[model samples]
Target chain A: MSEKGIHIEEHRDDEASKLGMWLFIFTELLLFGGLFLVYSIYRWQYPVNFHEASLELSVTIGVINTIVLLFSSMTIAMALTAIQKNNKKLALRLIAVTLLMALIFLINKYFEWGHKFEHGLYPGSDLMALLERGHLLYFSLYFFMTGLHALHIIVGMILLIIAYFKVKKDSVNSDRFVFLENGALYWHLVDLIWIFLFPLMYLIT
Target chain B: MDHNKTHITEYKVLAKILLLLIFCTFLTISITSFNLAAFTVTIALLIAGVKGFLVLSYFMHLKYESLLLRILVGSIFLLFIIIVLITFIDYSFR
Candidate 1:
């Protein structure tokens, strides 16, 4: 049953890829772990200050970004599904859409941050004067955490763009949907990170 | 093994579920803006958790995967979250 053996090996490779991604995701969590520790210490020491600072953030922006990320997640899924079904054209289109949406997300974040910076609300700037003591700490954490998360989104977009072109050139076929699958997994991780950040940054009472 | 039929059905269902999640997100935002701070955050996170579950189970194909693999991944994710919370709590408490 040499053929059966080969089949098993193929399956194992897929599992290995998934396992590798999972490990990377775990590392990502730890990366954010350090930030979470910093936030809690600051927040604990000055709860009232942080609460007041939190109000400066625009919930509308956070909500819109959440929607953008969620929509990107959907597009990535559709891309993978397209590849699985051997619809290369569809896959390419979906990946392109995802990349575009990611670009829009970055644009939105830039404007939001720019507004704050213009108002002298930047870190180590006049943030203390523009908002309450608690709020400054909260905004600082928001900027740092969300800035890091935004970087991840940028990286994910680059990966997806590369995958899109590869799929466009028929470089990745239905028999080899691993690229799209992994790309989607990365996007989902980005989405997961935002899901947590949204509440921590914008929803604390 | 009608691959075409199965693929179509899966894609359709996934799309519908994602749309519903998007709607839920909008609803959460709308409800929270009314000054219900405690309920808003909790409900928003609860909805987000639900949405994440759907992505993992349906879109990511975790449901069709092996139980061992599922447990392995789930435990790792949960462990990471625990580590984060614990460190945060330690700092906050200190």
Candidate 2:
């Protein structure tokens, strides 16, 4: 009954894109919700073991990665501002910064996970040595949940890289900056996951 | 719209403020590791909530968006909290 658009027609594409991103965000919440439920069950069953297992994590590394992500979040905001200003060059530069920050985040995670792996702390493999007595399930969930989150981060980074190139080629504009905007939303979701993860996995002792 | 270029500079300043927030997060984590009280998780979550709001408002452009999108996003967050609250009550009783 109602029409929407720049001309006589409606901007179905714009509204659809926003709806899609929101729906994707809902699914992501549920995905992480499952992991959170598992974590909750495990912690309730074995609080002591969970406490001990948390000590094995390098908070130093986690904090560093958090800051790295925070900076990237800032860069992406700048990128969006550049887009609003129609400064494609500045937008591209900011996107490059975001991509670089993401790589650094992954690099830090590599060593963090690598350390745990070296110490025989993997999911469903050999977590007995990780905790004091009984937290195999706990550590397993930690790795599985965090591992899955890290995978999402990697995917998000690739998306940011694509956004960088797309913006560089003048493909992103006020009319079609939906891709860039949604990409930023996806990146922020990744950041939001870590915001919860940092406390749940690290500070819950 | 062209006159709003001033907001571009504001965005950069926010970026710098985010760097400071990161430093605060690092400090919070480091101090937490050194055997803080039961407030460690609370403090960490508070810092995180602040950071999340900053991103949601500034980075996601919610601040500049219409009330419709804001209501949408707010309802989602409200739903999330309600779900968590109800579940926590059930779990705690168990």
Structural similarity to truth (TM-score) of each candidate: 0.83, 0.84
- Give the per-residue lDDT of model 1 (tens digit) for A1-205: 3855654332336556776886787788678867866786676677667666677778888888888888888888888888888888888888888898899899999999999889887778855556665676677788889999999998898889888878887877786666767878888888878877776677656
**Per-residue lDDT of A79 in model 1:** 84
Clash totals, every prediction:
4, 1
User: A58 in model 1: Cα distance from truth in Å?
Assistant: 1.7
lDDT of 2 by residue, B27-67 (tens): 66676666565576667667777877777777666677658
Q: How many pairs in model 2 have backbone atoms within 3 A of each other, for residues 3 or more apart or on separate chains, i.e. clashes? A: 1
lDDT of 2 by residue, A85-156 (tens): 788888888898898888998898889888877877676554455445446766777778888888988889
Off by over 4 Å in 2: A1-12, A127-134, B1-9, B30-38
Best by DockQ: 2
Candidate of highest TM-score: 2
